[model samples]
Target: MSDAAAPGQPVLADLTTIGVGGPAVRLVEPTTGDELLAAARDAFTSDEPWFVLGGGSNLVVADDGFDGTVIRVATRGIEVLSETDDGVRIRVAAGHPWDDLVAETVARGWSGIEALSGIPGSVGASPVQNIGAYGQEVSATVVSADFLDADTLEFVRVPRANMGLAYRTSVFKAGQSHPARPGVITAVEFELHNGGGVSEPVAYAQLASALGVALGDRVPVADVRDRVLALRASKGMVLDPADADTRSCGSFFTNPIVSPEALEGVPADAPRWESSPEAQDVAVPLGELPAPPPPPAPAAVKLSAAWLIEHSGIPRGFSLPGSRAAISSKHTLAITNRGGATAAEVTELARFVQSRVASEFGVLLHPEPILLGAFL
Candidate 1:
């Protein structure tokens, strides 16, 4: 990060998969744990807007730009804290690349996060959204997270119960509404099964079919990780700069859940599924699905976000306002900056998609990325 501006280095264009955003006021990269702590502490007291920049994957900053300190979490450390015949415990620094960690864990014969392979971001951000894919969420394997309390500046440990994990939310996300803590994620601890794949079953159908295994079937950890990466790459969910479809912050919207009454009204053609076991409600079509030939159109149940966007008339490559930002032609869910678009241009695209989908399907789309300057 020291050579941040050594000529021909359009930092944002190269760093983020989306290829947008302005230059940082000052970029802080701490290579060690102590350094990270010190940087956070200094930012805590400095009269400047501080953002704990992680992987810089899941972000949409304004072109007008952030007029504050950008503390990039660059600390690097990973270790097997302890192990047993049944399980292995691991510790990963927040700054570690999430997908790389998954690959390493699978390579070592540990299961649990294999299904989350290829997801772009820092290890710390995984807990923020409980990042999930192929039917497995990081929350399932996370034993606890060691974080720096944004307010008190003391290192605090948030266990599973206190983590407030849910559909794309956690204690820090929901709790932040009440008040802001230093909210800096420092490290994550995971207890993974050592026997075969993982204790948590594979729930996404695409993954099962891709691996030629049944839903809930356990496969080799490496195989699961590989298949998950392939599946993600197919949908542009994986970060691949060469592919326009991947010029996005992964999925743009969370799959919308509906109440039982709402489900009753959806067209019979939509996928209908449920979120939990005890809940007496069914999930119906909410959006579009990526082009994966074998999955039988996802049933008329839990509607795929990609499908909803397409059906809503927002096809890939859709754009507006004479801007380069466009929805990737390969996947409707991802809106790309097309090499030179600004945050404002992307927001315009997002707003247009949101309006179109909500009007057509009556389902409001919430952006997956955390917006710093604007909201729809």
Candidate 2:
């Protein structure tokens, strides 16, 4: 329904929070579920490359631009499927803004996602990345999702168990390749409890400290949401048109999870957390138990990418030669578009950072954003 040169038309730069990338050849904004399905099917059947866009917070497209159709999901709806003494189950449209839904649920005393406040992107994108912050990930609350599998040309209800949700990836993220032939998420369902103004046990240390509570203590949900928003704003994680630091794909790299042997030669004070065991062990049916466990494997460790970058000598606000794109002034983890930046510039900066980190620590940092025609 839209072209790149139409009056007030949107380019990738306008659509993305990073404010970079070239225009799409054609863009379709579908406002209904049926329309979304039809648009996806049309693009798939035509055998042309296509991309699905949500809030456009986690993308970096190439300067040459996409030559295929782009489907912008704009559909919106939320319905409570049922409520019980234990909790409530609700279904949300894929196009819904993630933070808005968090705010709404928090306002109504929902306990599952208060820690996810101020995250950018859409509800549908959450499961793809297993979006998490302050120690709470979408994988914890997701019950199921209604996905249109373009490969099979059928709608399938994928339960959380089948989603392959991990630290920050799922089957959906794996299917990002062949975009026109990938499964299209239509809606997601969540189960949240009525916590009576209280929150789930505080998990992240920074959040606990912000609320003046000890780790593992529960606080008021409203307090948690407010403090989370304030904390995110401080790091420029929340969107603000005037703040150059906020003009980024949030957290450009994921924390690297490595085997115990990979931690050699790193500084003693480097931030690291123990990685959880693989899901298969915990996901087995309740009554079915595996035989006696084999000897324990070396514990996997998750290292902080921000710590690695700073220690590797790349400081905040660092930029490549003659490029407007730079590391966020507020946080070492973000690569920001400091106005008039191009996708190539962003890519250049990212690659430079990765090289520095790898050279200093022997670990290559991988980008967290979805790259379209752009590579590090």
Candidate 3:
């Protein structure tokens, strides 16, 4: 465990993808899982407020910065736990780079995560957000994770069935319920298919169009990754040091999930999808009569935040006059720092966008990024 005090100033602005935020009072970087667990334990036992920092892609720190201890895990390893004829079960250290893991899996013909190519963040943070893209969600492949339970201060293994994973959120996230236990993830296990050099069938329409293939076509695994990266780069979703537009926490707002009736206020042509299909499959025992079906469950609707923002008159590349914070020129879903933008500016712009969408469509937009010492 590297308990050595950080030298000089340690500003979060230098660590995060977005060029904002102030300095941390103390920063600890653990190079191994044991060290990470140790650091987490120490933080938990102390009274100081602390947080685990991952890739810093889905976080926004206030200009005043976090006055608490910050634990940054640097543990690294990818182990093949088990292998069978059709699939491979592997475990990854929480600190492993997520895209690198995807690349490695695709190169080895593992098909489950091919569509999640260019997402930025660490493996540890993946399940917390149930990260997804191009119709491939991490929840679909995650098998289990090892963690240092915050409540008990003990290490435990949690299975996927208890994760409470849903669109863009999990029990590990704040304001969420932990079916198993809330803790700091130390490692994650995934079950990946041996695709024989092909990818999962195309599930997202945009991805299918980019690959010049119809939905359900299984392109080469490498090709899917290449196209996914290209798509992300085009939208400024991929991180790039030279692209100012890429200097942001990818999507500022999560698509608003609303009851079907609540969507009546939205435009008829607005892009919306059913969050979950009503369950219909049923079974009857041999020689036993089938029972009548119960009432169908109501399906929730997910409205596109980008479409709502655009329709509410907030266009891409928009910014408050004389303010450095602005909406990404490539994607309205992101609020960007033009350079030297403050947390106040970012929140101001976020609030403005939210107010506009709410007034126009009667729908409230919630931020996808975790705001530390800031609110929207």
Q: Pick the candidate with the highest lDDT.
A: 3
Q: Candidate 2's residue-wise lDDT over 180-257, tens digit each?
A: 227689899999988787899999999999999999999999999999999999999999998999999999988877
Where in model 2 is the C-alpha error above 4 Å?
1-10, 175-181, 277-297, 374-376
lDDT for model 3 comes to 0.84
lDDT of all predictions: 0.72, 0.83, 0.84
For model 3, the superposed segments whose C-alpha errors exceed 4 Å read: 1-7, 177-181, 277-297, 374-376
Our tally of clashes for model 2 stands at 0
lDDT of 1 by residue, 29-65 (tens): 8878888888888888788777777887877766644
- In terms of TM-score, how similar is model 3 to the real structure? 0.91
Tell me the lDDT of model 3 at 84.
78
Pairs of residues at least 3 apart in sequence or in different chains that clash in candidate 3: none
TM-score for each model: 0.86, 0.91, 0.91
lDDT of 3 by residue, 17-43 (tens): 886777788899999987998999999
Cα misplacement distance, residue 156 of candidate 2 (Å) = 0.9
The candidate 3 region of ten consecutive residues with least summed lDDT is 278-287
